[model samples]
Target: MRLAGIHHVTAITADAPGNRRFYTGLLGMRLVKKTVNQDDVRAYHLFYADGIGAPGTDLTFFDWPVGPRVPGSHDLVRTGLRVAGSDALAWWQDRFARAGVAHGPVEERDGRAV
Candidate 1:
């Protein structure tokens, strides 16, 4: 079978509300859906994305406010979004900075300034 594209990316979070605030409020992704995790009814599964909650745009999180995971045992991961140009990166940098969110400096990547 062939895969078309990524449907979504899901991660575990220690705080649900905080995740929602960052992803929706700061990042400008819409909170498209809010539901409970299937396996654990007490926890939440939050979905955030661009307009209309389209596939390939979604970033989700499963709430588990219990304990912190050991870092070195697992690979650290980061999510990247494609911006149009350096202008977009600058805009995003300003926005993030205004919101007091720390982010890496914009750099060139794969022949494009990101």
Candidate 2:
């Protein structure tokens, strides 16, 4: 069978708490699950999502104590969220500004906001 859209995205975070605060507190996601990494018992695996934690909306992270990487052009380019309309985009822009979160302007990319 062909694959549908992305169900979730997972990334590594050196600070789980900060990640949680940024996603859940600032971006208004819910903490769907809080559990330890099964393979590496000492670390945490966090799942954040929209209000009810729907499958396709899940954004997860693994709390590995990795040191910071030097800023380079070759790293993962960007992570984007698809907001429903221009209103939602404006809301996010305002929210990010009020929360002191750095964010670039919402611009049209391939006929959609990115």
Candidate 3:
């Protein structure tokens, strides 16, 4: 089966405020919604998407606001999101560096500098 592209991706965040700041304020993604978790009233469900989300540009989070998950489901090592091109990557790299956001040096992967 051939997949066109990603419609959305979901992840868990230990810090909802920090997550909101980073994804929306820093990365420029818009907050689509902020809702409470049905199971856990203390938790939150934060959804973010690129401006006027079209395709391949939605990120959501199930937040546990109290603290980091220990010995549980939050073990994802990395999540890759594609941008316009190498130039855009360079721009983001510069932005990250300037903002003190930790990021690896841009490297080529699958013939694309990421």
How well does each candidate superpose onto the true structure, as a TM-score?
Answer: 0.86, 0.88, 0.82
Better of 2 and 3 by TM-score: 2
Q: Compose the digit string of candidate 2's lDDT tens values, residues 1-114.
A: 888889999888889989998888788889999999899989899998899877799988899987657687465636787788989999999988998888999888888876
Model 1 residue 91 lDDT score:
95
Candidate 1, 1-114: lDDT as tens digits: 989988888888888888898987788899999999999999999988897777899888899875655778674467887778888899999999898887899877788776
Collision count of model 2: 0
Q: What is the TM-score (0 to 1) of candidate 2?
A: 0.88
Which regions in candidate 3 have their CA more than 4 angstroms from the true location? 1-3, 65-74
Better of 1 and 3 by TM-score: 1
Candidate number that wins on lDDT, 1 or 2: 2
Over 4 Å off, model 2:
none
Q: State how far residue 84 of model 2 sits from its true place (Å).
A: 1.3
lDDT tens string, model 3, 1-114? 999977788888878899999998889999988998788878899988889876678888888644554576657757887789888999999999999989999987788788
lDDT of candidate model 2 versus the reference: 0.86
lDDT of each: 0.85, 0.86, 0.85
